[model samples]
Target: MNATAGHDAYANSLCRQRVAALLRVPILAVALGACSGPGADPSAAPESTAYSRPRPVTLVGYDDDAMEPFLTRDGRVLLFNNSNDPAAQTDLHWAERVDDTTFAWRGRLQGVNTDSLEGVPSTDNQGQLYFVSPREYASTRATVYRGRLHDGRVESLQRLDSLASSGLAMVVFDAEVSADGQWLALSEGRFVGAGAPITADLLIARRQGAEFQRLPASSHWLAAINTGALEYAACWSNDRRTLLFTRAGDSSNGGAPSIWITHRGSDDQPFQPPLRLSRLDGFVEAPALSPDERLLYYHRRDGQRWRIYVAER
Candidate 1:
């Protein structure tokens, strides 16, 4: 089927599912009251249960092919990296959402010329693009680059050299933009030569007139544990008060990894102690929240491979 037709079909299917769910609410309520004991308050509201059945959202491509997906603000477009084609190297690609739960493959992004690896695409509130490239860096090192998309094309490619110096080997794996587009949360790691640190730490960079400046590390109880050495992926909450990040102990002895949450009053305030979200096992990375802030999507390594999973807040 053509792309447009496929998208229409997917949208219709989603609408039908929502209508069916709404129609069953009355019958479900009746069944619950009938099963309850006499004198029980049937009018009482039901407790909110955690989501168990995994509702898999469809993104175009094979399961093993796509990586590092960044959804647009409207959740209508997904930018990701795919290495499915044998002739072509890994490149940044985009997919358009047909409905709330379905996506169709679009095409390659236009006009950021470089043969080197390009992935980890981030979009600001206005759809400005920021991505990592190893093209011009010395010795295949990755650096952050930003550009503006205009008329279906990217213009004025510029590198963020003030963020780091040459040979520092900086990479921005994931970034989160605030609601007002004033602050940016990024997960950065500095790679030295061989025998470097095993993980990367989270950093907060605020938007100065036209550029960004990294904020100083906050003083929290957890920050005192190992102030200098802790690596994890972090994302800012919609209010920018809470930060969700993956925290792992030392990686040299195969330490356990889990998701943690830290709260702060504002972007400039200190953060509270971080608490673990899940039980210890496997490596958890890429913690992101749904638009409603009720669902979290993350990836965990099972055995030899990694799989995406979602949890309800």
Candidate 2:
């Protein structure tokens, strides 16, 4: 429409074309037709770019404050936080997925959520748990911690001190590890006046032995993901080639939070421009997908409380 907007759109198109040429692999089809073959999700539309309408999930025993749900690889288990309110009892809880819109509460995760703020539960297919905590209750050096989640317990608890917040004004808000344990994705936020993050960026780290380190090359690789917005909740797809993250829209423009997707052809290639997920709206964030990438999970504000919701192809 305007000169500036048109020029920006043209520049972005060229950038995507350049990356596509270097990758030499077919970019992910935005349509759901790829999954329309035999033994696929029959409910998936062969021609649509959107998913089914999201529905609120009922965590039977959990309170009216559930959010940030991480559905297990098998779609049987769910790990989430009750609430993040400082005045309330904030902790991580687990549930058994009873069906498409229901889960049986399994209670607080033992050994991890005691006397502190623990939230943002993320797990790879190997059952490794990655999450965030301010840890004001402990003399910890980091805000992110890792453990092995199994049978309603988090064992081998250890803070990833190496990836801790680098400054007093910043903290790791959300993070996840690759299924192969070779990569780590995190959202480090800088706080200003309010409690919410004033600025945030997604960073990628390469794993070496027991520790993960950020490299200079990751900035180039993730250049398209860490744009000029409130980006957080970084997640790696099952193949580790596709990335899912949330971009908070500007309150000035009446924009709401949106989940975006970007993909690379290989481990070394840069991600293409992020494409906002279709038909997802409202105050939704923390996008999580099943191992097959069929079911999408996120949380939305319902009046004064937050609740987990799921959308399927």
Candidate 3:
């Protein structure tokens, strides 16, 4: 099936599942597995023995699916986005664990405005959400917004309007909030031409009262490489000292992007030189560090499609 048709089919299936759940009916044909494609290797070594080998975790399928998944404090709930959704226009979606490795599709989390295009979901220790939205108030461009979750429901979303200004020209893809909720790290960039060039750089914003202000470029350790055209998808360590990001400089390098890590005194300080994490020739992007900082979860492209992989520290 074509991409659009596949997405529609998946959506219809999910809708059916929702209906079944509402009617207290149990249907037995739910296949939970990663979609097959060039980059998706069914034989890749499993990351952990704690989990079953060759078990497929559903990230996205059918439609041009890109998910930014993050675990909550308890690690039972997963929050992400389904870009192919036709109704909400690429809105945030959530899933909760039904068993050890199985998650039931809980409907879209409440609180996001249906009129907005929301993606890239991240959470802090306090359950506050930070995501990107192309809503009207955000000047019709991708801007970062935050909302607090109370009792599994979201409150009103508040945009970081100052970052959406013309001079900033930054499109934030992902953000990470510190455990204390005082520091925020984001992958953002300024547009150089009409097309969206992968020029995003890692930026740090500090919470000042009720607002966040961007820190100067010179303040971070990776400041030297925070240039116009070679970075995206940044994540922070639990302690907020180390940062992991993706770098795409030369198109001919490989199929997957490279992952880099940096260290700084604090969020306001400069980052050190970045070191490449994966030596594999494939493309690696969307690096998420485990809470203990011992393992890394990222998607690597083998050919046309991207597959999730876990790397041990």
Each model's total of backbone clashes: 0, 0, 15
The order by descending lDDT is: 2, 3, 1
Error of 3 at 130 (Å): 0.5
* Per-model lDDT: 0.50, 0.67, 0.53
Ordered from best to worst TM-score, the candidate numbers read 2, 3, 1
By lDDT, the best candidate is 2
Report model 1's TM-score to 2 decimal places.
0.66
Lowest summed lDDT across 10 adjacent residues in model 2 is found at: 10-19
Per-residue lDDT for 1-313 in model 3, tens only?
Answer: 1211212222112212221221122333332121111221213311222211222245332233434555565566666565323333566677775543345556677888465466656777777888765454333343678898654568977877655535423445557676667777776644333322334567777789877787675344566546533566677788777777765543223322456677778745667765555343355566665556555555554444444455555
Model 3 TM-score, 2 decimals:
0.68
Q: Which window of 10 residues has the lowest lDDT sum in candidate 1? A: 17-26
On lDDT, the stronger of 1 and 2 is 2
Q: How many Å off is the CA of 98 in candidate 1?
A: 4.0
Could you tell me the lDDT of residue 168 within candidate 2?
Answer: 49
